[model samples]
Target: MAENYVLRTQRLLSKLPFSSWLFGKVISRRAPYFGTITPRITQVIPGKCECLIRKRRGVENHIGTVHVIAIANGLEMAMGTMAEASIPRHLRWIPKGMTLDYTAKAGSDIRCVAEVDQSAWQVGDMPVTVTALDDNDTVVVKGSINLWISEKPSK
Candidate 1:
């Protein structure tokens, strides 16, 4: 399983021209504890990122439904992962804050898609919203993450 993740990361690196920051995000992401899970980043065009997660027992709550927090975390992951990929290498970003809305019950597996339409990224602060949806296409959770961007060392 871990080997598959590594291979996927390598495949992403080969296709996306990612910097070390992007590489690190994929490498450091904690996926194992969530059970037999797979995160596939399906799209990364300009200001958008789309990812999907298959629901497993580890992501289920006591009610046999997808846990709210788990879906929320996945939403955050989609947003932050997009930010890491969209932001230039000479800038650093961190999640300064976030807000979530648990609008519906997630009964099945989930997909998270996050997007920001900013043309150019400058050093400063910004907010991006990531959303997670259930198999029926209802929003399970929406997370708005505050990002702080700072200048990085000149290369």
Candidate 2:
């Protein structure tokens, strides 16, 4: 089986200097919009991914709270990373849509966690759940990312 690109890149960059910067650069190249959130992928495995986004002026709303859109971007990054590592090499996935609910005020840096069930791995629409937590570990955002999964094209 072919190695997952996200996993392979993470392993390779982890051995080099300034690995976090390199990883962010790679992610920005692939998804320009995600660059706006400046997400840091902290963990990625078969069915889960965790990402962090610092609270900064650029991502703040008029009320000095982290903007909803910024949180959504971070959530998406977490879900995308999880999907990349969880999907089989023979399978391909694309985000179809997302539904998010803002549950509280985000007054600090945010951590987003995305997870999928192994049983949910199949050629169809898969709904993954993601939650964003504030510095106090309070849930600030909850969302569901719907991804369309299918077989990879033959070479």
Candidate 3:
């Protein structure tokens, strides 16, 4: 079987209570920048990841709305984690860039989802679709993250 530790950890830890919160802390500790928005990793499966960020003071902007950068951070977290979990055995992936569109005002908590269902692990760029939904299930932000896929070096 493919050795994807990210997916393995998600499968194991997800069975415990408060697993999502715990997983978020673990991820943040590994990549401290993600701690800025305090994203909660709600789900992690092959090709898909779901995350949440509350409308807290630290993430608010001048107009009492969620900051675009904060939501972008949360979206990046979802995409990065999902890529780690879904990467193929002989291949590897890294996010090259992200493009986001602010379609609506982010007035409430945000739910970020990333999906990459197709088998696009060839040596090239693969785009993953990500969307940030408000409490009312409206898409506040939408975007795609471009990942550079390449082969893993031989041990």
Candidate 4:
């Protein structure tokens, strides 16, 4: 059988120079809204994923800080990639909802991370922990993204 798409894509892109940028570009093409923050998908592995978004004018709010919504987009991207890379081939998953809290101001570039325990994959609702951290490693946003995991329909 072919490799999982998310895992395969990450492996292929990491072989190239500026792989993070290229990978994010490719993903944004597949999900156009993620392009709004110009994220760089730095990692996508089973159980975890990381995405980085620079502190740029486009993502800045009126107060000259990275907008919370932009950070949210990054978080969702990381969660989706992590789920896709980690889930068993027999399973399928989709986002059900998200609950986020803005804990601190995002004063610098942000790194969004999504993580799930290896044993957490099952046929049910799972809460994936996600966080957006500033360059100083301060948690600016903390949340859990709810995902519905189920057995894939028989072909």
Best by TM-score: 4
Tens-place lDDT per residue, model 4, 26-132, is: 88888899999998998888899999999999999999999999999999999987887889988889899999999999999999999999799999999999999
Model 1 over residues 57-139: C-alpha lDDT tens digits? Answer: 87788988888777766666667567755776567788888888888888877888888866547777777868888888888
* Candidate 3 backbone clash number: 0
Q: List the global CA lDDT of all models.
A: 0.67, 0.89, 0.90, 0.93
The best candidate in terms of lDDT: 4
**Better by TM-score, candidate 4 or 2:** 4
Q: Write the per-residue lDDT of candidate 2 for residues 49-121, one digit (tens) a residue.
A: 9888899999999999999999998999889888888888778899999999999999999999999986788
Order of candidate numbers by TM-score, starting with the best:
4, 3, 2, 1
Better of 3 and 4 by lDDT: 4
Which scores better on lDDT, 1 or 3?
A: 3
Candidate 3 CA-lDDT value: 0.90
Q: How many residue pairs clash in each candidate?
A: 0, 0, 0, 0
Where in model 4 is the C-alpha error above 4 Å? Answer: none
True lDDT of residue 153, candidate 1: 68
Q: TM-score, each model?
A: 0.73, 0.92, 0.94, 0.96
Write candidate 3's Cα lDDT for 1-155 as tens digits: 37478777777888999888889988888889999998899998878999999999999999999999999999999998888888878888888999999999999999999999747667899999999999999999999999999999999
Which residue pairs in candidate 4 collide? none
